[model samples]
Target: MDKTTEEKFVTLLEENQNIVHKICRLYTNNRDQHNDLFQEITIQLWRAFPKFRGDSKFSTWMYRVGLNTAITLYRKSKRTVQTQDFDAVMFRISSEEYDDTVEQQLKLMYSAVKELNDIDKALVFLYLEDKNYSEISETLGITEVNARVKMNRVKKKLKKILNP
Candidate 1:
């Protein structure tokens, strides 16, 4: 990367720190895990930076790198810690209304996500974030038919988990 390219890369990353942070929160659950995941994601993004052609919006492309990194970076072989104590911490956005019941629902969603196979989790995350089938397919380099099938399966699985 030349000086100009390096400057451009820095600018892109500075602009998308929120994207990285949001994905980290969703994927990692808590502080230690969040920091580790953030570091891993930053490394992955830097590694994949060269391959980012200007074919799509930067946010979308960033999401692809992020999802891939979170899905494939490391497998935690041992379970650690326990449930989040409500009084200690929670996920909240000032721009959105925060109801305790909704927080519980969000927790349930995250729990269900944690139980998913990596590819399934990626599909689920993308679906929840309102990605269209074509966009998800493109991001994951899968065919539209495959993306559709996977999304249907994900919805059914989420329904079962949420209902049961």
Candidate 2:
């Protein structure tokens, strides 16, 4: 990659790193796996950076590439031997205070989400991020109608997990 493209890629990644991190957290059960998936997604983004045509926002492109990496290209065998507690790696309470009830509910929701299949998890991620059906369809390579249907199913499943 040329210096210009490299610089541009770095800038864009810095701004949208949270998207990659969220994907990493959603897909991996442990911290080692999260780090591994994050690294793999970064490498894939860098390699595919040259092909980015700017047709969409950089964040949107990053989402598609990051999801593709996490869902398809990442290998579980590469995870490190060291295991970390899922809560320790997945959730952090900053200095700002939060409600205990809300925190517990959020944890339960995260647990339910983690149990979903890969594609369902991806759909949930996109839906939670407020992506419209069209954007979700484009990101996941599914029809808009399919995206809507899948999202409805995911919501129903989550409701069952939470309420049952």
Candidate 3:
């Protein structure tokens, strides 16, 4: 990449890297896998950067590419275990003051999200990020109506998991 393109990519990526992190966190089971997936997504984004038209918000385009790369690259594995490392430094919560109830609830929610299939997880991720139905449809290449329906179903599934 030229210096100009490199600079642009870095600026855009720095501003929106949280989107990639969220996808990585939702898709990967452990820190190692998350880092690997994050690298892969970054590479894919760089390769596709030149083709990015200015039609949509950069974050929207980032979500589309990041989610696609994650779903394609990370869904081949069939791991059933969900492992999360909740270090105090990572979560900004002091170890001595950690709340067991909050930790347990967080673990339960993460487990429930981990149980969702690849596409549903993407939908949920976008939904949680406050992406609208149209943007979700555009990112996932589904109809806006379908996005709404699928989001409703994902919410119900999450509720069931939490309640059960």
Cα lDDT of candidate 3 equals 0.77
Which candidate do you rate higher for TM-score, 1 or 2? 2
Q: Against the unseen true structure, what C-alpha lDDT does each candidate score?
A: 0.69, 0.75, 0.77
Residue-by-residue lDDT tens digits, candidate 2, 1-164: 67676777777787788888788767766656776677677777877988999998888889999987887743444324222233422222122222234435456777899778878888998888999999899888999999999888999999999899
**Cα lDDT of model 3 by residue, 50-130, tens digit:** 999889999999999998888877655553222333232111211122123543546667789988998999998898899
TM-score of 3: 0.81
Q: At residue 37, what lDDT does model 1 achieve?
A: 68
CA shift of 77, model 1, Å: 5.6
Q: Against the correct fold, how does model 2 do in TM-score?
A: 0.80
Over 25-51, each residue of candidate 1 has an lDDT whose tens digit, in order, gives 566756676666666666666667788
Q: Which stretches of candidate 3 lie over 4 Å from their true place?
A: 79-105
Greater-lDDT candidate between 2 and 3: 3
| Model 1 pairs in collision | none
Candidates 1 and 2, the one with greater lDDT: 2
Clashing pairs in 2: none
Worst 10 residues of 1 by lDDT: 89-98
Q: Is candidate 1 or candidate 3 better by lDDT?
A: 3
Using all chains and alpha carbons, the TM-scores for the candidates as numbered come to 0.73, 0.80, 0.81
